[model samples]
Target chain A: MHMADALVSPAVAGAMYAASTAAAAYSVKRVKHEDDIKKIPLMGVMGAFVFTAQMINFTIPGTGSSGHLCGGVMATALLGPYAGFLTMIGVLLIQCLLFADGGLLALGCNVWNMAFYGCFVGYYLIWRPMTRRRLSGGRILAGSLIASMLTLQLGAFSVAVETLLSGVTKLPFSAFVAVMQPIHLAIGFVEGAITAAVLLFVYQARPELLDDKGKSGRQNRFSYKRTIAVLGVFAVITGAGLSLAASSYPDGLEWSIQQVAKAEEIEAEGGGVYAAAEGIQSATSLLPDYAFPESENRMGTSCSGIVGAVFVLALCVGVCYAIRFWGKKRIK
Target chain B: MSKIEGAVRELHRVDSIAGADRWIHRIYPSVKLILTVFYIAFVVSYGKYQLPRLILMGVYPIVIFILGDLSFFDALRRLRFILPFVCAAGIFNPLFDRKILFYAGEIGITGGMVSMAALLIKGVYSVLASYLLIATTPVEKICFSLRKMHVPAVFVTQLLLTYRYISVLLEEAQRMAQAYALRSPGQKGVHFKVWGSFAGQLLLRSADRASRVYDSMLMRGYQGEFSCAAVSKCRQRDIGYLLVWLAAFVALRIG
Candidate 1:
């Protein structure tokens, strides 16, 4: 569910960056508490652990394909949400730098989609509540499976939503969701099972790690409620903004076209001001039709296709050579 | 099996390049970092059908790659894994958007086709820009610059430490995988049944190592924030670099 930079517009990327950074900032602040200071190395090491875990791809039984763990739910279950989220940022940063698995700009979106949901939604809503009554192995497994699936689903949906909002691709919202959700759902099940096994093993090894007082403390009045409230408000604001943009998008495109076509309509009415404007437009326009010259002959399409291909190829070659030339001169 | 080994080497490959003595490696990391973010933001900010303008912006990555003394083929190789994602995001465009954007003679070019081309261009360019940045800049410099830019010290420290220890953990994981593979011959990958215990063992080992690392840090007078002596001072060229690229990006965006 990693989104490429091309999949999002600057607006969508910026919005996600703001959202993810806010979450990261919140986590950083929470992590700065004196009590939380000692977990820094643990967070770092766990981040490494996550990175390494992804490499050990296990084959799914009865299927030839192999899959790896996502580690977000497991991280949260092991380290608590605040540290878990930060650890995720670390793992993601390394992955981006080393593998280019997700590019730099989309890092924020990747983190938001993959980390935030897994750490917060998985931990608070599903894992915590499900495993609260008793720290049984079965409970942990079930919690991990459900929470992992939920977070992956949420992440996949966000990818679709972000792409739609950006309008970078012509993927309609429903179609994009239809394609992304089910595939991610399958990946989520495998990830969930892997997560459960890992968590269960850790729970068996160190039960205190899973049931720490800080994590399970019912006395903390502000933790879950405040976080949920903040996230809810953020979601509402973003949702409202996206909906407004989505509704206006088609009309916006048509309106721009109307301004061009309407220029002729105004000329038909024969106003002096309109004629002068039309005269200027005709004189200044490179393409007289203000769009691609519609030719009835197939030759224009074929010719342009060849010409455009050559032009693009030549441009790329020219740029590369120029850079190389400049580099050599600078070195000399 | 071999995938694990390949991954470890790939992770190290970039770090090895980052240590090379190039002008890009010498520049203030913050400048390169900020410029990369701006370049991406500007590139992606364009309308979906703005293919020509997006193509112009591709110059940024090419220039950076050459100036950084990096190989274009190496950069392209790094981009191999990410192309599928870009393709997946865009493959349905021609199908979903059949509206004629314009006609080139007898043929009607759909908005989807134009946008798909634009999307692929944007994806490749953005990935290249990011890959170039990492290839040229060391992780420590990035973390240090990030700290200088007022990113939380804890977060930066985590980034630094995590990067440092990734190799160690990978080595450990590789050992376990080798052991598993030796015992279970002819298996293409690890059996799903052992994934629990296998990953469990890795976690146990990592937890033990993490505690040991914390103890070692305490013994070395490690405080919460890492204080390094090699603070990078921003030079005049750094500002010039930023302004020139910023101006070019703004111009392209306007186009």
Candidate 2:
């Protein structure tokens, strides 16, 4: 389910870039974190493991779309919130450049949506509480299912929101969310099962791995203070600079859907014979995300640029606080 | 002076910037990343209706591909692995996108043709840009730039360590596969159960070893920051490299 470059607009792309840069900077800060230098290997190892795992594909039954594990959720399960996020950044960056799985311009969005939620929220809210002292297979299974689904849902929704704000999509918010959330929900379910399987296998053979990491102690996990500072500085620059350069047009899919829908509604929207032909593809891309918007007729790309940066940073802050709140309430 | 430079050179060869004894290896990754973004941004901005702009955008990267200094034939060979995904994604575009945005005289085809072409260009252009960047820049220099840019000390450290360990784990996986091949040697050789269990075991072992290695690294005063590479002082000639591209981007954007 990779988002294509053709699917994103410049405004949305810029904004996401700003947001992602901030997140990346924040992640670097999050990982090195005050002196617990051991997290370095933790991040690298997890990234490598995830990369290898992704290379090993699994069949998807009748669909025949042999999808591999995304590894974000699994990373969260193994690493704590902050470190998990950093590892994912590594994985996504590597995947984009070396493997060519996702787009360069779209990398920021993909990493943030897939990694951010899967790492922080998935861990603190679901995995941590359930897996806390006495781990249960049942708890792991249930937590994995819920957390994975929720993470995908948020990611899908974020794509929708970004598209809309960038003015790319023509679909109403509710309809778009309805279409995106459920499909991603199915994908997330399958992903969680695989993650649980991998971990369960490890647990059965060697629960000592966790103990080993824990004993590796202050060196292994990450330093919070310094990581946050470094990340915070980058995020600030990205958020500020990106905000200044964003475009005003609607995003890609949004523009097409809106145009086709408008043409169908009015007999002479484009007033051409090709009008009916446009309807067919528009009808098929009916998934809420079909509303991907590329703003075509906008005047100022600059104002939207500023808005994109501001909104992404604000959204990230919202997610951080939301996960913290979720963890506090859920964990004993 | 000569003694210190030699030691540093040896240390660099042994650790970061693996085999980066070429000219293209000197460009900064952030510069590459910036240019790639700007390139894609310009490509996607043209209304789907603008054919000339689209075609022109597609050509710019091809020029870079030629200039990137890699053997033309070898460069194309590198694209063999990449071609499949681009083909897969593009193949679907025309089939799914039958909207006749424009008609080519008589025999009918969908706008998906243009969309497919667009997707292919986007794919090829970005891939070419990245190939140029990675092939030229030593991974270490990029990490070093990241450090100067204040990327968290930990993230940068992990990228380097993870790269180091990839060889270690890959060797282990390779050996395990070899042993498996020797044991079964036939259809049974590729059994999922055997490979699955083997991968699982390797994973746990690697994790444990990595943790140990990390602990020792910490003991050795690795405070997460690498000494930024002393790139040869930027010469006036370097302006030719940076400016030529900047000029190209502006010309493309406004033209």
Candidate 3:
């Protein structure tokens, strides 16, 4: 579940952005040995692949709405916790920029809540141990299903906790739980099963994939530097890149709070909110609130979306080339 | 095709105010990015119970609304959908939290009330600020701004690529969803079994796509610095704009 712009406070959103970027950079650095040409393509392509996979939806059995693949778990399984996490960031970045899925401020929350938990916690805490213990296709399936569901649940819960802590949503714990938990539970269950199936399938077909050591070979301790550097760049890029796609909406938590909290509490133009808007007004320069002013045009969002896509593509391609150029220089 | 066309059509349908373009759209993307940082830092750092301060929090962004091209009501209409979450999250503070803090005339605003108020305020401020920024600037400009900011060229490029790719994927997803709906409109959502199978199929397909993308990189003169044709070059005004915005951001954060 993506967080929208409406439900966030500048404070919580900023803190999360900082935290997520920090973690993202850390993750990239963690994949030091894997920063070779082979991995580069995989990283970029896998990021794209995640997008396409999300496009095709699968029915959720009894539910009328279909559920698409949440790539966090799959990425973690293949790319290791660190790389997987960065990849998930890539996925969310794409969603925000091109798809108008998440808000700019909410991007931090989404990256931390949705991506962090799905890749790292799900992989290291649950999937790894579970899969390792059994090492069977069924184990991979079961592990992924459980990990994915748990991760989503945690991410959803984190949304509640973060919102509550940030004091953005007025909904009390009980009522908010009543609203968020069940819906997410449904989503989580479906996502988990989907994640499990993918994990199982991959395990059967390319058993060596997840075993980084078994594949091209693990990077030595000396190469750890690459991981840190790559991750640092990844975080900054995503933060600045998909920023164009950051929405003007309230995100999931804020939307939920507005539902439970009545009118007076949820005044749209109350001087209270208007005051803070001015500060932000002082703050934003380029994209302002991610969308242009009313005087622009109807196609603002789409125009912004197209711009964002180009931004991300260029950023990614640029970084790769720069590195290649650097590598060649060092060799010479 | 029509749905895509509709999105395109809707873009052309709406019209913006006069000075809106120069003030909002033409502003450098760096201004938006920095301001976002400034605003988020302010909102997230506040504790859950600072009610009066929370109420005061909303003024800054709303005042911007007052000055900007977008009317207050339009901004609210655009953001109202997300209010429920933050609003609801705080409402429960009163129910579980029985200890009352203040009795304001008829209403008894407790610690929960304070917390809820803070949350609602936070949600509102962040939402408003973000809305105003996006409403003004286009996405591509933001990327160029990021590049100018020296935000790791590789990362910026990936972001651009990823953003472009997702839309294609979304269309693909939409197509797949349409196919799915056509096949199983009568049936409930895919069963868990089918759901897993379908998702797995997507992931595997993604992996293949990833491999193919990697190959293409070699074929092209992919030396790694990801540049784009979206922007021709920087404008002379870009420097002046960035400086003015940076000054304002500092003033707000310090205050």
Candidate 4:
């Protein structure tokens, strides 16, 4: 799922951008270390292939609707995770700029959701495990299906969490999750089936491409556990840091908690933990009551604000056209 | 098949617009890129109830659209697919938030309604800001700027190559899709049974094309290093543009 800029707060967006950029840098280093210059063109072409492939939709049986290829797991299957992730970055960048399929600010989140999970988690956890012992028709199909579905599930869940954290929407967390997950489950199934079909076909046509026997040495040296541990720590640190930043700034996180607090009637338990947390929240809240001081002339001020906004917009348009007109006259 | 063709046409439209001769297009690509990011951040940073301030942020895109000599309707038309999703994202706001914020001529304005409007404006503003950046800056120049900003060469190279070849692959896919559609009359898409062969054939062909592309690169004495023909220096005007936009953004955020 492509997250729009509206769905993410600056804090969440910045954290995601940092995470995805780090991943891209790491992928670049890994790909360079391989020293196989041949992969550059292949990655490029495959990136384009994924781009075009996404445009070609196939109808799901009995659904009357259609789905297209996501191509993360499929790309990683052909190219390793590192290259696949980078290729995805390329495809997504083009999509953002050329078609505006996803927003630029949200590109980081989109990449992590669509690419990181599929390329890394889908590959290491599901695809590799399913096809580890040997390559077979059933293994290829099962691996693609499971990997696609699992990754889509993770991606969809992340989207729900991110939107909730952003607080731009009034959607309750449970309600948002309830809607996002099932829809993606269906999408994931279709994606999985298509991925399976493609991978199986490639396996039959050029089995050598799917064979990882030759690259086992390089692949084994890269420990998934160590990478995951490092990433886990990074995420934790970023989360804590962002939460602190968000608290001081009174951002979406605080707003969301307030919304949740209002929506759910929680009895104030006379417990040490509850008291301490409440104390912390009040201490950290920029607006302790989450509203500005009421003024007798509040209506007047709001009316003035709206009037000023309209005036500013008019002035902006006037200046723009004025300058354009002036420039054309000067040229003439 | 029409979807593929439509996408290719959209890509060309953006490319052609980016290549247009206009003051916005003439500015340094990196400057436009940075300003767009700043503008989006500024718009998104406002509180959900800050509808007035959010409305003020509309000035940036409106001015850019006029100065760039672009049609607002065309831009909106291009964004038709995404605008609905953005709007729908905040549709539940009014329901979840019912606290009255203000009164408008005997009608009470709830916080939810205000926030929903704010969110919709934020989405529109952010999308427009991004569209402006790409509409003004060519993809090549954008990549070049990325390289200058210390983005890795490998990634930049991949971006350029992928951009270059997207049309080629899209055409091939279109042809293949047409053939399939013709063969499977009344079918919605290629049958699931033939998906493997359909997409598989495309994949195999793409791989073969990649091999040939690599061969051509090697023959041209490519050694993994890409050189740009034109190097864009940050002129004084570009700096002025950046400073002006930064000042405006700061003023908007604080004013």
Candidate 5:
């Protein structure tokens, strides 16, 4: 699932944006350093290939829900990881901006979770090893399934951790993990199967396209092992750090209320600008209850307050509309 | 709408809206991009219980809808698909966070309910703000802005080319689906068994097309860097756009 902007805190979102931007910049450098003009068109076309393929949603069995292709594993398989990473970024950016699939802040999270893992980690760790020298269907199938599933699991878990770090949702880390992991596992399997099938077909139809740049999978395997190890440690540190903060902070609503209440108590104990603000508030207290004059019960007061709020909202909307009309007339 | 048809319509709708020349639309793409990011971050920075304050951020999207000449209801409708994910995650809030924070009549409004409201509001406002960005700025202009912002040229070129070819490849996919539908009457979308082959064939076809495109590029004195037709210049209005949105966003965040 694409992580929505609301799911992340500014800190988590900013951190992710930085991470993804660095990774993207590295990918761009690698792609640029190569400067292979032939591969440039391949990158663009393959991105579009993934985008179009993603549109053809397939009905998942038994659940009746439809799922589409992610295309990351497949893109990585076809165009080595660096180029693959760039392509996935392009696809996701278009999806975020044009389709509104995800928000701008969360785009960083999406790119890292979806593209970075699928291209770099999945490519080196799983797909490369499985498809070495042999173009067999079984190898392709097994590779895609494992790689796609791994990337998706990592992506989904990252989303869970992001929300945990954001601490915006009341979803406990365990519960979020429990819910996110299994669903993505299923999606990952389906996407992996599709990725395998397509890659297998492409390999059979034209083997050269699949085999060219993915030549040094063995050389990179060593580095990836260390990369994966480092990532594991990083995850643990962040997860522990964030969960600690999450547990200590009461839910956002209560925390804010406590802060406000604490501030008000302090204001009452002292006196200054607070007294002036209180004087003004008291002066404008028409009903002395921020509600209707005849309202007796708490429910009545709340209802009247709601009515007044709606009235003010309507007035605001009317004024905006009037301004728009006036602005259009003046422009004409 | 069928998923494919809806995808096509969405692609066209944003492209058409971005072509509009209103004040919001005319604002520099980089300025709009920065504002969109700032607005979303501001909306999301609030605590989950800050629903009322979060609601105030609705003015940004509402004002955008009016100025950008976007259809409000249509924008909301486009967001409907994302609701299920938000709801699935949010539905558990009330179940998990049962500490009663306050009460309205006999009903106790728990922390879960308040946080859930905050989550939903955050999701809606952020999504709407992003929708406005795309609705007002064309993809080409966005790529130009990204380039101007010092994004790597190769990456930007890929983005531009990929966007340009999405519609073309989608049409190709549409044709393929139609042909398959005509032959396999009473079938809904391409059958699962055919998906692999169908997607494989599409990839193969596109790969061939890409090579042909490369050949054409070579014939036309191909350069490594792809150049854009549009010149990106930040006029005075663009600076004003950036400053005003940044100020508004900062105010929202602090207030």
Candidate 6:
């Protein structure tokens, strides 16, 4: 579910970056307020542990293929959400830079998809509630399984939505969602099972680690309402900013909506909000239909553009070789 | 097991190569980071059918590879796993979009074909830009640049520590895997039945090690933040490099 830079437009990427940055900032603040200096090294080591764990693949029963741990739910279960989210960010960033597992520009989307859902939504909704009053083997297993599957589904759905909104692909929204959701369901199941196994082991070995108060022995006082309010404001800002940006580039979100609804004419006759937005869109649209100003000789322009591109590539290669040659002479 | 070993070696290879002294490597880390981001943005911002313009963006990576004394084939080899997935994502483009875009001789090229080609180019270019940045800059320097950019100290501290400990943990995991394989031969991977004990044991060991690590840091008067001795100042050439790349990116976008 790692999004490549090619799959997202700048507008969508920028909006996601803003959202992820806000989330990260909030998480850092919360972690700092806790003031557990020991968590610093623990978060780092655990992040590395997750990284190593992923490389150790396990064989699936009755299937020829193998699966590995995602560790988002496990991290959250052990470290709580704030620290877990930051640890996942560390893991994802290293993967992006070292292995190219995901793209740098698309890091925001990947973080939101992989880290945000599992750390925040999985913890608050599934893991916390399930393990709230008591700790049991069955609760640990069930919580890990449910949280993992649900978060993976959300992450997969977000990927589909992001790709569609980017409008770089020709995939229809329904078809993309249809294809993405089911494959992830299987992947999610495997992830859930493995997460359950790992968490179950920890539960038996060191039950204190799985306690609701977390490792610091303090109550987890993170407020759901406050978080939601902050994130809601971010969502509103991102939505408005994207809408304004999408107006100028009609081929992105606008194109996706048109394709999905097949309702290009609805906005043509609508009043109120639609009419006002349409007015703003038309006013801001530089290339109304994503077409350049009329060119008399289109083929001629294309031919020249191709030639210019080839010339520039050749020039780049030539300069590179020249630099290498000069460096060799200096060394000699 | 081999996968784990290969990954460890791959990380070392990239890290070692990044220490090489070269013109591109000598350029400021933050500047290269910004340029890489801009390069990717420019490549992605192009229209779907704009294959020619997209192809032109390839120059940045190609020049950087040569100047950095890096191998293009090595980069491609590193990207082998991801490139296929990237291609697979766009493979449906040709099927969904069949509008005939232009004619080549008597053959009618569809919009799908052009966009598919454009997507492939975009993927390769973006991946290369990121790989090149990390290939040239060390992880610590990159983290330093991130801190300089006002990314929170806690996150930067986490990133540095995680990177530092990754090699240690990989070694430990490899040793454990070797032990597991020796005990259970003919097993494809650690069985699902033993996953609890196998991974759980590792997790327990890791937590213990982390506690000891924290103790050692505290002994060294560890604070919540890290300070670096070799502070990199932006040179005149760094500014020139930034301006030149910015101009080139702008020109390519306009052209």
Best by TM-score: 4
Please state the interface RMSD for every predicted structure, separated by commas.
Answer: 3.4, 14.2, 14.0, 1.8, 3.2, 2.0
Query: Can you tell me which runs of candidate 4 are displaced by over 4 Å?
Result: A213-224, A227-239, A248-295
Q: lDDT (0-100) at residue B111 of candidate 1?
A: 74
Q: Candidate 1, after superposition: displacement of residue A55 in Å?
A: 1.4
DockQ for all candidate structures vs. native: 0.52, 0.15, 0.16, 0.59, 0.53, 0.59
Tens digit of per-residue lDDT, candidate 5, span B1-255: 166667787898888888888877777788888888888878887777655556667767776776556888767875775666777778889988998765676788777987888788888888788888888889998898888888887888878889988888888888888788789887656666776789999999999888988898889887876676665568998898778877766665444
Off by over 4 Å in 2: A4-6, A25-34, A58-67, A156-187, A205-332, B1-22, B27-30, B71-112, B177-199, B215-220
Give the lowest summed-lDDT range of ten residues in model 3 chain B.
B10-19
Candidate 6: the clashing residue pairs are none
Better candidate by DockQ, 1 or 4? 4
Q: Which candidate is the best by lDDT?
A: 6
Between prediction 2 and prediction 5, the one with superior lDDT is 5
List runs of model 5 lying over 4 Å from the truth. A59-67, A216-222, A240-281, A285-315
TM-score of each: 0.87, 0.67, 0.64, 0.90, 0.89, 0.89
Off by over 4 Å in 6: A213-304
For candidate 3, the TM-score of chain A alone versus the native chain A is: 0.63
Whole-model lDDT, candidate 5? 0.78
CAPRI-style grade of the A/B interface in model 6? medium
lDDT of 3 at A49: 63
Evaluate model 6: give its lDDT: 0.83
In the range A1-332, model 4's lDDT, one tens digit per residue, is 77778778888889889888988888898899888889899999999999988998787777887789888998899988899999999999888777767778889889989999898888877787677689999998888889999899989988877776677788888988899899889889899999888888888789988865226325664456864776588668756775664454555544565587773334786979999998898767533332222434555455556666777799999999999999889999
A1-332 per-residue lDDT for model 3 (tens digits): 77765455564566678878887776655555455545655665567667656544556655567676677887777777666677778778645543345666689999988888777667656776676545886777677778878888878877776555444444565666677788887787777777667667667666676573213334333133543464466557545643432444454444565677743254456567787887678566444333345525323433343344345445545555565567568979
lDDT of 2: 0.59
